[model samples]
Target: MLRFENVSKVYDDGFQAVKSISFEIQQGEFLVLIGPSGSGKTTTMKMINRMEPHTSGTIYIDGKDNNTYNASELRRSIGYVIQQIGLFPHYTIEKNIAIVPQLKGWNPKEIKARVDELLELVGLNPEVFANRYPKELSGGQQQRIGIARALASNPDIILMDEPFSALDPITRDQLQGELITLHKKLNKTIVFVTHDMDEALKMGDRIAIMKDGKLLQLDTPEKLLHEPAHGFVEEFIGKHRIIQNPELMPVIDIMSETVVTSLPQRSPEKALALIRQRKITNLIVVDEENKLLGIVSAYDVIKQLNDIQTIDEVLLPAEPFLFDSATAKDAIIMMDESPYGMIPVVDERKKVVGLVTRGSLLSAMSSQWTDSEVAE
Candidate 1:
């Protein structure tokens, strides 16, 4: 765990990067610091390792003041990864990763083991990459090695400063996926710094929004997207954030139960009647036991206007299903794959519970829109 109390920094040139800020980071929490350049995100993270001492206020690492430990000793316990992917050109990949272990006086065999463990952990094959120097590897490979190096000592804390910013879009995507997988497995208390809001939302367990050298808000990704604290935060969070947050609108929140019915037969007349009654383009159908059967669409019914039978005549099978608590974001993904106007929600028993529509999700988010008259 880490804590910062009333921390600030003012340079000799009269530039201030951070103002008095206080916050606590829980153990194993992936906290992201996000804001525009010069927002003091980098300065705040550096203060944790004592690389840049705070001009005022005290920082505690696991309850003890950070300043209490020797600078080098304190750094050894904190792993850092940066945009440049800094690596010693003279050292082999294995030697680069083993630097921290060697500094701690680990035996050669132990350090080698640590290097091997980290290489495989970061998705690199030690047998192939161990002997390669920094120049011998591609940019992404070098960055992966840097990560392995940082973890060599098994640090409880890891700081990442735009670690994937330098890579191509495809590589960046690949690495972000890898980092998510790695973080879940390692469970280190991570402090990630990024200027990109989308990246922050995807990676951060909670985001700390900063502006003008001060903390604006700290909340879960859902809260930040749904409710911006002030005009400053609204400006930083971007214009379409509300529309983008389908995760906050769960399917259970706005489902209509009265409109759903069970039927195995098909009838255009009945489907049209149901549409007119419910004021919807479709209706849900299920088995006698309440398990999901399929959906009856007005479009399909209208296509067969002369047909008359059970609703199954126009009913289209619902592709894949989700539970009630999977989050609105998950729904958006399913919808995108098939462009569903609405999707049925099923319970643990595979029985239809309700439904969620695109309009419902957007309207739920739109309710929190900020007044345009407010200042940023």
Candidate 2:
């Protein structure tokens, strides 16, 4: 829970780094600040932990003025991670992570437990990495350690300033995914700063676009993609960029309304016959009220035709289904885990409304590219 009220930062020589930006971050929200160099994105983040104090306006953390707390104490209470992971070369990974908790006067046993837990949380083996020095690890590992150290004290808020920009593309992508998982698992309010629009869209619950020391736009990734408020915002996030973000497309637009469904009580022979007649790969098994029960694949129905009395006996678990309100991105992500390359879309009452198959999903996404090309 952080709020900035027309916040500005001016240096002693009168260089205005931030120009009265006002925004509020909800609890457990992943808010990203993005802009080009000298755009005050970093300065805005620093002002949160009082690393660079704001020159004008008020900053409140947890409903209280940030200035009410001691600067050193405030810094210690919040987690901070940077692109250049500044881990001490001589200190062991365990010591580096334990610094924050140790300074907070946590007991040795608690600090050790916390360090080991954080190491595993960042996907590193504590037994192997805890005693190793920072230099002993690779760049990605060091960045992970930096993250672990930042999270050492289990702070409620974390500030990440281009934390993954320095890693290789593959590693950067991997770390981005890992950090996303961590954000959901930890549910900590994260203020991430990055210059990359792709990374911002992938990471942020809401993105704040800044330019020339002013806040230009602040909105959800979907809203920003569809309706950029400013000309500069549109230029910054190009048409191609908007097309690339699958979250912009509603799942309903790509899903098929003609879903082949069957009652769970249907005989295996009849269900197989229906599957063949309809040329459908899977049958959506439902109740008398049309609520989804499970899915029966044609392969399974044929295999178990003589072995089972009813189609329900060979039913596969209906998982990874999306609500009608979901997005194309949700379908895209869940498609891999879906059996038979199909995802059932359901309504508020758990009734099957539509289905998203691989074919339909691909077709919709391909059309986005075509549209982008035509617009260009």
Best by lDDT: 2
**Of the candidates shown, which would achieve the greatest TM-score relative to the real structure?**
2
Provide the lowest-lDDT 10-residue window in model 2: 359-368
* Every candidate's lDDT: 0.78, 0.86
lDDT of 2 by residue, 1-376 (tens): 8999999999999999999989899999999999889999999999999999899999999999998999999999999999998999989999999999999999999999999899989878899999999889988889999999999988999999999998865457557767877888899999999998778876789999999899999998767877789988877877443344568778887788999999988998898778778766778989998889889876567657789998888888789799999998999899767645679999999999999875346444433545656776
Overall local distance difference test of candidate 1:
0.78
TM-score of each: 0.69, 0.70
Q: Write down the lDDT that model 2 would get.
A: 0.86
Work out candidate 1's RMSD over C-alphas.
Answer: 13.0
